[model samples]
Target chain A: MTVKLYDLAHSRAGDKGNTLTLSLIPYNADDYELLRVRVTAEAVRHHLRDIVAGEVTRYELPNLPALQFVCQQALTGGVTTSLTMDTHGKSLSYALLEMKIER
Target chain B: MNERIRIGCGAGFSGDRLEPALVLLQQANLDYLVLECLAERTIALAQKRKRQNPPLGYDPLLERRIELLLPDLIARNVRLITNMGAANPLAAAEKICGIARRLNLSITVAAITGDDVFHLLSGDEKALETGQPLTASGPLVSANAYLGADAILPALATKANIIITGRVADPSLFLTPLMHEFGWLPDNADQMGQGTVIGHLLECAGQLTGGYFADPGMDVPGRKNVPDLAHLGHPFADILPDGTATFGKVAGTGGLLTLATAKEQLLYEVMDPSRYLTPDVVADFTQVRLEEVGPNQVRVSGGRGQAAPGTLKVSVGYDAGFVGEGEISYAGSKAVGRAQLAGAIIQERLRDRFPDLRVDYIGSTSVHRTSFGEYPDPYEIRLRVAGKASTASMAALVGEEVEALYTNGPAGGGGARKYVHELVGIVSTLMDRRTITPQLTLFQS
Candidate 1:
């Protein structure tokens, strides 16, 4: 069954320079491996391509059943220079949650 | 000394609520309360203020926060540590001592300086990412390196009631007490890394305690309950001699602490799990474990570390021109269409002046950006356009275009707001740690 990533996991977004780091953690411990397999870096890059201008790299942590994706060149000059209201990219984690995943 | 020490966070940022911190001081038995109020560009702003007036660079809320919590802190004998001094630690310390004197409280406040490397830095220093020299990145305002806990230890050893600092690493505020209490060596990477992890978790205050963790039905485990964020409780950590820590909040406080929240905060802003660099230690968060030992209490352990970075990260702020923004609301029938039309009108009108002007439909794709595809026409939509330019007048053009849309473009548009402000751009660079010498100044009241 298809479900939104929000239904499977919760995440937080933080930024450094032009990079945005989003940490995606599953609701259930059992769903970690499934998410690890389905939510590839390319998949996330494709999902957020409209906003992010650069590459995406994913790091896995089985201990916490979490995936941290670093989106490079994501912020349009980051907090001090970005023209957008959400300069910190604090709301971008919701974008990651909006991605669809197979349940 | 206690085998386990309790460290509480009073304020997460400069503007965080004071009541929660007061509640923490009155309720929780803590050895230290650290307030992390400085951000990447805060010191730059403070420096600008200090230039305007030599003795006015500290946080605006310094007096109010100290007034509210001073008597309680004095009576309870809990030490206070903060980077709230911003650009002027000496001035902040004097103000704090003055406050204590007025209250007839005997307290020793120490100011830790030397984070400011503005005079020591040269214009030829290259940025870490852009490889462009600092001279090319506009006129420099301020440059402060992220000092480690070592800079704070000497002041802590003096047994001061309050320690004020400027531009120290966020985690160093919390780690300094741990090091002072446990007599941990400066090169004890494993312990420093563990302490950094604890600092990182509590650094955000209520974030791990459900302030930012609650998402209604989405947050896992026990966080689904609606949080009373208005009375959100601050966070505290109980650290043992072996680098293990347990995070919790005061009982009956308005937040929840779970393994899920801990895990989320554990990775907050972390770029690499194996190499989380700070001025003190290169922490490894990969092996860290989180276990809910009890309700609203999570035990975290297993943080590994390697040698600290030879070079320190310096946040250099410079002039980045100006930004202008304007927003107008469209509602009722065809609200989305009206907002889109309004956006089109601004884009067309300001094409020449603001070639890079960006428009966003706040009610629809402004945040997630079409990841969920189109939504049904909303009851209301806010159309926002923003752009950057070299001068205030040029930046004002972007907002002016949006205001013109009231009569020139879409129908049912109302409540227009426009703003323009100067921008301070920040860039990161590396400097040799040995050159920067941190000093401590002690004051008594």
Candidate 2:
């Protein structure tokens, strides 16, 4: 079944320079392995291709049942120079959560 | 039972809430109260202020924060630590001492310096991301290294009532006290890593206490989905000698402390779980764990660390020209068309002056920029155009062009606004730790 990533996890976004890092922590601990298998770096890159100008990297944390994705060149010119109202990419987490995941 | 001490966070940033800090000082039996007030670009702005007038480069709210919490801190015997010093720790320390004297309170203040490396560094230093040399990046404003707890330990040894620092790592503000109290050495990576986790969690004050974790109808039980943020309580930690800690908020204060909140904060700004770099030690957050021990309380432990990095990260700020922004709103039937027309009109008007001017339709693609599904023809739209220029006056022209659209192009356009300001460009580089020496100056009242 297709379900939104938000239904399975919660995320928080933070940025440094042009890289936007999103932390995806599963709502249920048991879903960690499933998410680890389904949510690939390529999947995130494909989902955010419109915004991300650089590559996407994902780091796993089985202990926290979470995944951390660093989307490079995601912030137009980052905090100091980005003209976007949401300079820190704080809303990007919601965009990532909107991605469809197979349940 | 292991020996433990309580540490409370007063203010997270330069402009954080002051009343909650006062509450922590008056109510919590805290041994130390750390207020982290410096951000990446804050020191650069402070340096700009200092250039205009020396001794004015500290946190603007420093005096107000001191006035509000001074008496309570003294009464509770809580020593204070902060990077509120910004670009001038000595001046900030002197001001604090002066305030203590006015209140007839005797105290010792220690100011830690030597974070500024602008003069020491060669102009050819390469930026981490762009690989562009510093000399090629216009006039420099400030270059401060992220110093570690080593500098702070000496100030703590002096037994100062308040320790003011410039450009120390955020986590070091909390980690230094734990190391001092527990006699944790510099090479104790595991303990330092554990302490770093606690420091990182508490560094943002209310972030781990449901302030930033709240989302309606979401989040798990024991986690407050709808938080009371009006009187948001700052975070405090009860740390054992072994580096395990329990996080909680002050009693009768608004905010929730839960395992979920702790987990959210754990990964904040963290790039890699296996190698979180800081001046003190490279902490590994992958092994960390958070458990809800009781109501509004969570026990956090299991942070492992590796050897400290030989080089420290430096934030170099340069004059990046000026930015001018202008916005105008259009509503009614053809709002989207009107806004788009207004944006094009401004772009045409400022094409010669600001060839790189950028335009955004607020209701359409202001944030995600066509990333999200297309917005249906909206009832209202805000047209915004912003650009960078060599001088303030040139930047101001971009905004002026947008304001002209109200009368010249778009019908029903209103709420036109414009602004021009200087921009500070930040570039990160690393410096060998051995080159920068941290020194402490003492002031007595």
lDDT of 2 by residue, A1-103 (tens): 9988878888889889889999998878999998999999999999898889999999998888789999999998788777777888988887888788787
lDDT of each: 0.89, 0.88
Minimal lDDT window, size 10, model 2 chain B: B218-227
- Which tens-of-lDDT digit does each residue in B100-177 have in candidate 2? 999999999999999999898786899897888986777889999999999899988886999999999999999999
| lDDT string, candidate 1, B1-445, tens digits | 5599999998888888888889889899998998889989888889889999998988989999999989998999999999989999999999999999999999999999999999998879998768999879899999999999989999988969999999999988988899989888878899989999999999989888987776666445453563676688999999998879999999888988888788888888889888999999999998898989998899999988998999999999898889899999999988888898888888888878788888988877776556366467679999999998999998898778788888888788899999999888899899999999999999999
DockQ, prediction 2: 0.64
lDDT of 1 by residue, A1-103 (tens): 9988888888999999899999999888899999999999999998898878999999999999899999999988788988776889989988898899786
